[model samples]
Target: MSENRAFFRETVEQILADTLDQSRIEASERRMLPAALYKALEENGVTRMLVPEGKGGIGADIGDSFAILRAMGAAAAPGPIVETMLGNKLLAEAGLEPADGLIALAFADDGAAVLHAVPWGGGVDHVLAVTPSGISLSASASWEMEAALDAADEPRDTLRGSLGAIVALDTSATLRTAAILRAGQMLGAIEWTLARSIDYAGERKQFGREISKFQVIQQMLAELAAQLLASAGIAEAAADAGRETLIAAARSRLGDAADAAIGIGHQVHGAMGFSKEYALNHRTRRLMAWRDDFGSVQFWRRRLAGGFVTCSREEFWPAIADAGNRRAA
Candidate 1:
């Protein structure tokens, strides 16, 4: 890792270690924001990491931001961390001042009347709406909110309101940006699951021996480790390249990795993994919740397939080669 990224990761890890805990994570599960944790993030300028340096931010690279997000996922840090970081950048790009407190993020469709599954819609006072025309900020009071939750029991409310004032900007990149970042989160959660499961296997007893000694158990963990490495590599590439096709592929591949984590991790832990009180359930459930965010696995798979389906036999190889070269560049 670069010096800056290593420092960035250490800082995020410290903030999370200091401000986030099991109790706070449980409160978040019940739909409450970890105010202290977010306050620490804001106080440290972590929330504004993406905004340009000219606009009161450190102007950190996407890799730096991705490392923080991956750490958040591993820790299961609650609230709209990703949303706030990206939202501040959007606001700065539009020459608007940075927002305090939490900000929900949504990409509104053309002629869409309501924004659905908005992350932390009810908890946050502001929403950053990115559309084909422009990006805009809308106050929470202007909208009627319908309460909802994702698989992890985190808020994913719906909102109906005007987008307030629109700021002209190219809004095409938001979804891809969100997708690759969310994929990083998913990768982190999967990593947690695999680590927890392996540790448990080593300590768990079966047939007068550690379960980890069994060939079956060893194979399962080995497979999960392989999946984690693959997901981590692709996710890093997607975050670095920011290509729509690469992001789609990364999200789709990570979906399978998440499933493996949930299945293998739970199988290793047996009944303990299913308990609501156990820590493993937290990361596993989040894997289910976040896998579909930004875009569903099926949706991304279809998107990736669409890119290749239109090519002839002669053109397919070159298209694939070009994509790889572009991503490498």
Candidate 2:
């Protein structure tokens, strides 16, 4: 990481450490936004981290912003931080003024009146809607919301109304960016689970000794670690490069990693892992909820496969080679 990136990461970590706790997280899950936490994030420039420097943002690189996102996931910080950051950037890109307070992001078909399962939809200041044709922003007062929750118990409300005039833009890039940033969140959650499982294994004794001593437990942890490593590498690269094919690959690969993290992280802890009071459950449930956000694993898999199948036999290897090239010109 660059010096600037390190500073951003540390600042996010400190904010999370100070503002987030069990009660606040639980409150968010119950559909109450953590107002103070969002305030702190905004005060620290995190909310506008991606907008241009002249526009009151840090003008941070995509990779640096993504690192902060990963930290948010690891801390299991609540609310729509990811959406707000990207929404502000997109708003600036369109020469539109950024909205105040929280922003919720959603995708709907062109000409659609209702947007469903929008993250933090009911409580945001504005909604940044991305469609096949373009993007638009609408104030919260312009729409009606039916409150709901996702598997993670976070707000995933439905909005019924029209967004403002759509500005022409590359919607695919918008969706890909959302998908890969989500993949980074999943990566951090998986990392937390693996670490938590490891710690539990070391301290929790079975029959005669620590569960960490068992060959089977060691094998499982090792396998989970391997998955986490691979997922992290690809997720970071996709964020840095913002390549469509690479983002597809990262999302698909992280789906597998999430599956492993939930399985192994719980299996090691036995019944204790399933309890709501346990920290492991928090990250695991989020992994389940977030895996299909922006797009599903099957959608990305099809996207990845579709990207390569269009190439002739002679162009196949180079295409695969190109997708993995993070710094490709």
Candidate 3:
């Protein structure tokens, strides 16, 4: 890793350590991070890391942003980090001011459908909704509410109904970026699950011996570690590939990691893992919910398969070679 990226990771790690209130986060679940935490992040410009310096942001690269996001996922910080950061990048690229609070886009199945802005909570100053076709800006409108599919209990809602309007920015790149960001978040969750499970096994005892001493327990941990490492590598490679490549890689790995991590984590902790009082449960639940968000594993798998089927084997090799060369160079 570059020194700059190391520094960026350290900076985010410190910010999360110092500012994120674990007690409050555990209590609220999905209800946005505390106002104080949000203020601190905003004051430090963590929330706008993707925007250009000229646009009142730190002008960080995607790699740096992903590192920060990975830290957030590891810590399990509440609120919509992917949605907000991607929205900030989209707005900056569009020459618009980055809006504060939660910002996510709502898209229809039709390829040319307009995306509408949905706030994280009830109200925000502005919302930017971008689609592959174009960018849409709405300042005054009643935000629609839909139920979130994730496990977080805090204020989760989706956007729907006629109160919302869509604009066309044709920004497929931004949507792809958001997907990559989600993959980073998944990586963090997987890492946390593996580490936590190992720790729990070592400390928790069964039959007068440490559970970690058991071959069965060790195998599970080893498998989770391998999956986590592979997923992390794929996610990083995908992010470097840009847009669709990143999304495909992330979708493939995150789903597998989430399933493996959550299952093993619960097994290691046994009943404790399912208890709401346990921290492991908190992290695992979010992993379960997030895996389905953006696009479910099945959804992305079909999409990826479709893409591959449409291309001849000859065409696929060149695309893979080109992507590898881009990352290498």
Candidate 4:
């Protein structure tokens, strides 16, 4: 890893350790991390990791930002680091002031769901709403907050306001950026789930032996570990790749990772895993929710397949290679 990435990893890990305080709360409580953790991040400049130094941000590279986000996911911190950083980057790139609060790109259900301008409430201060046409932003509109469906089927309130300004820019780049960040979060979740499951298995008893000693248990753990590692590798590679390629890789790897981690984690924990009292449920629930957040596994798989089918093999290889080169440069 580069020095910047290593530093980012260390910084985020420390922040998560201090803020998460494993003994004080369970996983369910973690969902509130974004609201609770926001102050610390703002004070520590964590939220500005991707913003330019001149713009009061840490000006970290995309790879560095991904590392920090992954660590946050591992700790199950509920902050909107990915949304803030990426949104800020997009706004700054667009020559606009970075609006405050959590800014996320919303995709219309219409199959195209590209970038279309839509009015959003001012409560969020910033938002990226995508339609089939292009990206749109509303910084000054009054927001009306109402509950909306999140990836996990939980009711997440969305701020609906007027369109202060609409910019019809191709959002393929922005969509790709969001996908890479989301993939990093998934990687972190998989890592944390696998480690926690292993720890639980070693301590929990079954059939007069530690559950970890059982061949069946060991096999499950092995599979979970493999999935975790594989997903982490793919996510890291995707982060290193530029936008489009990152989206493609992340769409596939993140979904697989989330499903595998949740499946094996619940299996290892069994009945206890389902209980809200158990900390495992927190991670598993989020994993389930996150899998469908930006897009579901099936959604991305179809997207990747469709893209591949339309492009020649020669063209496809070059696209992937170009993404890698951009990251290196």
Candidate 2 per-residue lDDT over residues 5-101, each given as its tens digit: 8899999889989888878888887778878789999999998998999888889867888898888889888889889998998988877777789
How does model 1 score by TM-score? 0.96
User: Residue pairs in steric clash, candidate 4?
Assistant: 34-78, 34-79, 115-131, 115-134, 116-131, 120-161, 121-143, 121-160, 121-161, 122-143
Taking the tens digit of each residue's C-alpha lDDT, what string does model 3 give over 25-109?
A: 7755544456666677778787798999999999988878788888878888777667677778777777778887656554444
Candidate number with greatest lDDT: 2
Instruction: State the lDDT of candidate 1 residue by residue for 1-329, as single tens digits.
Output: 78998899899899989988888999997888888889889988988999988888889977789988899999998788889898988899888889887899988865466999998987887888888988888787778999999888899999986667678888778887888878878888998899899899989998899999999999999999999999898789878878877888889889999999999999999999999889887898899999998889999888777778877999989988766333311
The C-alpha stretches of model 4 lying farther than 4 A from their native spots are 21-36, 108-125, 130-141, 149-155, 168-170, 310-329
Quantify all predictions' global Cα lDDT against the true fold. Answer: 0.86, 0.87, 0.70, 0.66
Cα error, residue 175 of model 3, in Å, equals 2.2
lDDT of 3: 0.70
lDDT of prediction 1: 0.86
How are the candidates ranked when ordered by TM-score, highest leading?
Answer: 1, 2, 3, 4
TM-score of every candidate relative to the true structure: 0.96, 0.95, 0.86, 0.81
Query: Higher-lDDT candidate among 2 and 3?
Result: 2
* Candidate RMSDs in order: 2.0, 2.1, 3.7, 4.7
Better of 1 and 4 by TM-score: 1
| Total residue pair clashes for candidate 2 | 0
Model 3 TM-score, all chains together: 0.86
